[model samples]
Target: MQLRSALVTGAGRRIGREIAIALAQGGADVVLHAHTSSGDETRRAVQQHGRRAWVIRGDLSSRRNVQRIAREALEKTGKIDILINNAAVFFPTPISALTAQEWHTFRQTNISAPFFLSVLIGRQMYQQGQGKIIFLGDWSGRRPSRNFLPYCVSKAGVSALTQALAKAFAPHVQVNEVAPGPVLLPEDYGPEQQEELRTRTPLQRFGSPYDIARTVRFLVESGDFVTGASYVVDGGWLAQGHDGSGTSL
Candidate 1:
């Protein structure tokens, strides 16, 4: 088999950008998806790597858009061998201030989009007899960080979806989740908060988006034997436990 093509959502920037470039470098053509980000730079990167790259923009908040993406992408480029659900809505939604719309947005973006995208692509892969699906989860999702309640809940759902879909897709499509710890900190993020993440990590260091991207490439190239498993690239933050003893995610 000549290498396969991949669809990586949220490929406009950050980890998504890194993953798209990595996949292209590893010999996979790419379909870059994003809500607002045009992914022009990422597309150029993929093309520079000598793989064909296509850009598809749509808001993940709309179920229709999510559903349309798989069909549209496949229509443009047949049989996506890899699907990476990397687009997500993350924010601190406290109970006192969280609203119904915010809750719905979290679920729709973080969980619903990944689930439906997997379903659409998995069906195609099933017909073709193979595929790889990866969902971007968060360490906080498994551990439940304070303030970021809904985002965590949504990611927790992603973890659940990965395991369930791995079984559902069965012998054809291998599904997995990549739960990142503190990969890329925003430029404005407080130094004090950075220390908190580093202190909590057993590796005693912050991770990079490249770390997550490398893991994504690994899963895509790992072949069809692995499924229903979540690879946490969190520098061992999760191994400590979530009962509020060591450090909050």
Candidate 2:
């Protein structure tokens, strides 16, 4: 049987990298898309799995670039069996300091880019009669955060987009989302802050990137009946309220 092809956006580092490699391990050729072109390690990791890996670099925040990426991936791989919208921008946007530029940038990358990418790729999947599209969402989307207002709102949009596409794509394509919580702490966060996050999590621990990656793998490979669902891989963080005493420096 011929292998399938998958395209993973923002797949140069962190959770995106793991998702790309996991898909390759599942016998799929991968088109790894990186914005700002900093995913050499991710490309190497996918190639190490003995699957063909193509690196396509572009800023998904731009509609032209988004279209170019979809076109290039299909051109190189011949088919797109999976599309993972994993690239996103996370930043603090307290209501006081929020600016129009900040909101536009965040919305364009986090919401508009993913929606457009899904529409284009989904059309291809519909024609193919079988494909999967996974969006990387966040727990903050369900439970809003005071500081990261725009990012949380953007992810909430992602969650809704997942459901909308699932219905629109129907029996031909499967659309779903994996929402992760505190899997990887920001670079400046200290041990005390990490402990606080762990305490809030009912599981009392942080989740690894691999944990999110595995959930995505399952949805893509084994989740035939699953569509329009948001899988929470938050180590139970949403089970409790947020206790804000940490400092991000």
Candidate 3:
């Protein structure tokens, strides 16, 4: 199916921003959402590609907001050909100090939000009889992270959700996942930590947001027969059997 429009969440910066722009370059109008940030720049970039760009600012953690996301996106562009469930909150939640609030936050943002978005949007795609849904998961999801207990559990749920949704929306909506690692360093990551992480990866290098963006494009633009797969773009980190599974440097 030709991609006429895409809804990208958390697209104010980093991977989400790149994905939004890449989709625009691929000739799809974009609707970008962010919880606390502005997607004005991303919208401008998408608009620069001669495609319409709509910005929606709301917290995915809110069920009301999640319910309205696909509705607003479809209202803007009339149809949503690509649904990128990319909004997630990542943090370290050691089992020892894991709090109920922290776990709630992780599950709400990382799991529930995406699930709601997919159900609402997937039904639309099914009705149209053609569409693609790409969930942004985590590399730690495949291999559990020692320091990110809640996050790992949440992301693992996403992996399962991908497979379940793929089956539920079969023959119409192709559901897949992109699990990225070391794509962008955190603001608090130090140089020593960065170097250590770089050496641990089999690729000996971190990934760029565009790297993930390219992967997302391939999933939407091609891969018609592919679904229920979690594609990890982690510089071979997981394959190397590396002990560094935490989402930080």
| Clashes found in each candidate (C-alpha, N, C closer than 3 A) | 0, 0, 0
Q: Report how far off residue 230 is in candidate 1 (Å).
A: 0.8
**lDDT (Cα, tens digit) per residue for candidate 3, span 138-222:** 8878777788778888988999999999999998999999999888987788988888888888898999999999999999999
**Best candidate, TM-score:** 3
Give the residue spans of candidate 3 off by over 4 A: 245-249
Output the lDDT of residue 249, model 1. Answer: 36
- Across residues 18-135, which tens digit of lDDT does each residue of candidate 2 receive? 8999999998889999987677888888888898998999987799999999999999988898999999998777789999999898899999999999999899889989899999
lDDT of 3 at 203: 91
Ranked candidates (lDDT, high to low): 3, 2, 1
lDDT of each: 0.86, 0.88, 0.88
lDDT of 1 by residue, 1-249 (tens): 344799999999998999999999999999999778878999999999999999999998888998889998898787798999999877667678999999999988888888888998899988898889999998888778667788888989999999999999898888999999888875567878788867767899988889999998888887558898888998887897752333433
**How high is each candidate's TM-score?**
0.94, 0.95, 0.97
* Residue pairs that clash (backbone atoms under 3 angstroms), model 3: none
| TM-score, structure 1 vs. true | 0.94
Question: Where does model 1 exceed 4 Å of error?
Answer: 1-3, 242-249
TM-score, cand. 2 vs. native = 0.95
For candidate 2, list the clashing residue pairs, or say none: none
Q: Return whichever of 1 and 2 wins on lDDT.
A: 2
How many steric overlaps does candidate 3 have? Answer: 0
